[model samples]
Target: FMMKGVTPGPLLFQEQMPLIWILFGTFLIANVLLLPTVGLLTARIAGTALRLPFNLLLPIIAAACVTGAYAINNNPLDVGIMVLMGVVALMLRRGGFPLAQVVLGMVLGPILEQHFMVSAIKSNWDPLSFFERPIALILMGACVATVILGIIAHKRRLTGGDESS
Candidate 1:
């Protein structure tokens, strides 16, 4: 959609009602047809994937990631960056830091930046104006709460919890 200069949002809904209907119908049919069979087979599929020997599995996953990175733009730098990120992930794991948030941030950061830049440009580059939006405030509050909760949980883990409480 983006490549074709189509942004999939409310504007897309208004501009392309037929496309929306087609997408909705396709998703509805897919869920109805695939959900039950996929749900039933998930356990077996996961079990088989998990059963792979780590010695062999690690290389396969690494190769797949590297291949995917390079294949995206046929750039050697993409492969190098993937390998570097993998090493960074390994270091993070060794440091006992959670990888999920790091992975999430890496995935979301660019998209967030793009939208934020658009929002800022619309707002005359006033960053403070961002918090004026209720949704923005709510999301910021959620982020703060999550960080506080994570810190509390980490402290509890290190101190073996508050046994008295």
Candidate 2:
């Protein structure tokens, strides 16, 4: 659904603008070609396969997740962490907590921290500089709005009001 051309490589290596554009084109082409197959597979899995009983499918899913974690680096620690996170996520779901927010925070927290640190360094450690940029202010506003809307929607759901926000 998206294309990622340049990754977080060293600045020196990423300075090759021509190569970066070429890589972007390649990634875009590959993603476009694969989109139909990916869509079909997702539709098939969501429509039929995912409707199986949890008791029958959970073990298989757990095994697959554990295997994937281990396959990442052939490390038991990865598997342990995966299982721990799985348990925590299950508990959160049972408690009526939205898992998407948790996942988004987990994935984006470090990236945001790194960017903030870099910006502060570039600004000679001036914290106020973060609010000086128009883009940054707009992004901050968007973040605040998203959180507020999410809270309102959650409260509405809890109060048995309209859920299709």
Best by lDDT: 1
Clashes of 2: 0
Question: What's every prediction's RMSD, in angstroms?
Answer: 6.0, 8.2
Predict model 2's lDDT versus the native. 0.87
Expressed as tens digits, the lDDT of each residue in 1-165 for candidate 1 is: 888777888789899888889999999999998878996699788789989999988998878888899999999999989889989999999999999999999899999999989998999999899899899899999999999999989988888898554
Off by over 4 Å in 1: 1-46, 134-165
Clashes of each: 0, 0
**lDDT (CA) for every model shown?**
0.91, 0.87
lDDT per residue as tens, model 2, 1-165: 115444556662556677767778999998998888997788988788778999988998878888999999999999999979989999999999999999999999999999888988999998888899899899999999999999998899898897575
Segments of candidate 2 deviating more than 4 angstroms? 1-48, 51-53, 138-165
| Candidate achieving the largest TM-score | 1
- lDDT, model 1: 0.91
